[model samples]
Each structure stands twice: as structure tokens, then as C-alpha cells.
Target: MVMLGDILAAARGSAGALERWLAHADPQLAQDTACAAKSVGLGIAGYARMAVADFSRFANEEDWATLVSSLRDSSDPGSTCLAAMVHWRLSAVGCRAHSIPQEAGAKDE
Candidate 1:
């Protein structure tokens, strides 16, 4: 996993990789929001978030849309999820970001 190619292989495609990484990272983060918030900026999660953000150019409309919605979800401070979400937006800032005008699984408007 030292090479860029190795890292690329672990991520699969350009999307859904965050969930996979998180599964390996702190699977409990999804279940423990309080723990996640407290863990933010104090662990690899921060670097992981930054890594996700680095994928902006690789993100599709669907990817961007999910990221935005996740950011708005403050139900639990959005901790670990927020890390990846923020990165996704930042990475997209310089590019022609894509997104769904409607919610996920909703009919397109």
C-alpha cells in the first residue's frame, strides 16, 4: 500500500470509498457520534477526510450531491462523515462540480 496504485486499488472507484475506509477506520464512528466528534482532528479521520476531499475532480454529480447533504446533516455534529463531506466540497471548489438537484432516491426535478 505504499504506492499510489495500491491506494487507488483500495478505494475501488471514485465513490462510496469513504464508507469502505470508515469501515476499516472507526466502524464505531457511525454508531457513536459523540465519540466521533471528540475524535475529529485528533486521529487519522482528519487525514481521511482530507483524502476524500482530494477526490473532487473524480467525483460525479451523485457524489457531490451526497457530500452536500451529508454536510447539512447536523443531527450528530456529523463528525467523521463531516470530515469527508467538507473535503468533497473543498476539492470540488476548483472544478466543475456535479450534483443531483433532488435528494437521493427522489425523482429528479
Candidate 2:
């Protein structure tokens, strides 16, 4: 989930989504991380003010999008109240976690 957040941050850029997200935030919560600048000092001062847009700059945009997409697709989906579908499809004889013998799992992927 942390990675997912990071990927989302990168896709959102330094101003677009952060400003929009802040617009709907509780006033105190928004004020708490209110800084628009980057800080790299010691102690609590470093985090006294922060912004959401500053994150996920660590990864290349294209690669990040692909990675996030892959992770999202890997999870099979279903609504608990409905007839099961994706979960059963993934558990089919030749798919996903069933593709290999998990009992004797391979290491060093």
C-alpha cells in the first residue's frame, strides 16, 4: 500500500492533486502539513510542514504507472454479496497462485 501511495503521488505531480485534495481536507489536518517547500533539517522542524505533491518524485512516471497497474490487476476481485467470480477464476487449475506448487515454494525470485 505504501508503494501504491508513492505511485499515486508521482502520477499526481507536485501541484495538481495535492491542492485539490487539500481543498476538501479538515482545516486542522490541512494546516498541520501545510508547507509548500521542501525541508531537510534536523528534528521535528523537518516535518513541521509538508505537502502531498512532494511525494513519488522518486520513480520515473512511465515505469511507476506500469508497476501500479500490474499490482492492481494481480488482485482478483469480488463483491461479498454477489456470486463469486474473479476469485474462482484465479483459483482455476492453471491460473495465478495455482500455476505452481506453493507447498514447496521457490525462493530467490
Candidate 3:
């Protein structure tokens, strides 16, 4: 059984990765990630600060959507990259937890 603590630890790791990615975000990668999400019908909103704790709740499709909406909507490249990273982590968590479907734009590339 997957422990909540393990999931949270992974989420925290993802957050750390986000910080690193933000420091040197690649425009091409960000653009590709956004396109991948859009191709799967996820709406991109505008930039808004995502709570650090949100990373710990990838237990459902709704949670995934919330993250995508907040992160992908950003006009800033760093935020876009962060969205991509968050999506990657959430997708992995969803697969491991079997909470989210594979068809929900979970593919990062």
C-alpha cells in the first residue's frame, strides 16, 4: 500500500524540481508541454500563484485540472515550465495511485 507520507515526499521533491526548473526554464520545453496539454483539451488560464501544498493532492482528476489551469495559464515561461513539471509529477502519481485516467492529457510529451 502506498503511504500518504510517501506521496507527500514525492510531491515535495516535485516542488523542489519546480524551483530548479524555474531558475532555468526552457522556452521550447515549456511550449511543448503547453501544446501537449492543449492538444488533449486542457484549458490554459493566466498566471496565478499556485499554493505549494497543492502538489500534495494529486489524488483525482479535478486536482490535476486545477494545477493545469493555474500553471499553464501563465504568460511567464517559468510558470509554464513549472506547470509542465507539475503535470509530469501529477501524472506519475496518478498512475501509481490509479486515481486519474491516462486519457486526461497525462502524457508529458
Q: Which candidate is the best by TM-score?
A: 1
Q: Which tens-of-lDDT digit does each residue in 1-109 have in candidate 1? A: 1333444444454425545555565566433422332344323334444445555456678876776676466443334344455345334433223331122243432
Q: After superposition, how far is residue 15 of candidate 3 from its true place, in Å?
A: 22
The whole-model lDDT of each prediction reads 0.44, 0.30, 0.42
Best by lDDT: 1
Model 2 per-residue lDDT tens digits across residues 1-109 = 2233442354345444443443353343334333211222211112211211122332346544644465556542111101111122212234343232223344434
Candidate 2 residue spans exceeding 4 A from truth: 1-7, 10-14, 35-109
Candidate 3 residue-pair clash tally: 1
TM-score of 2: 0.24
Q: By TM-score, rank the candidates, best first.
A: 1, 3, 2
Question: For each candidate, what TM-score against the reference?
Answer: 0.29, 0.24, 0.28
Candidate that beats the other on lDDT, 1 or 3, i.e. the better one:
1
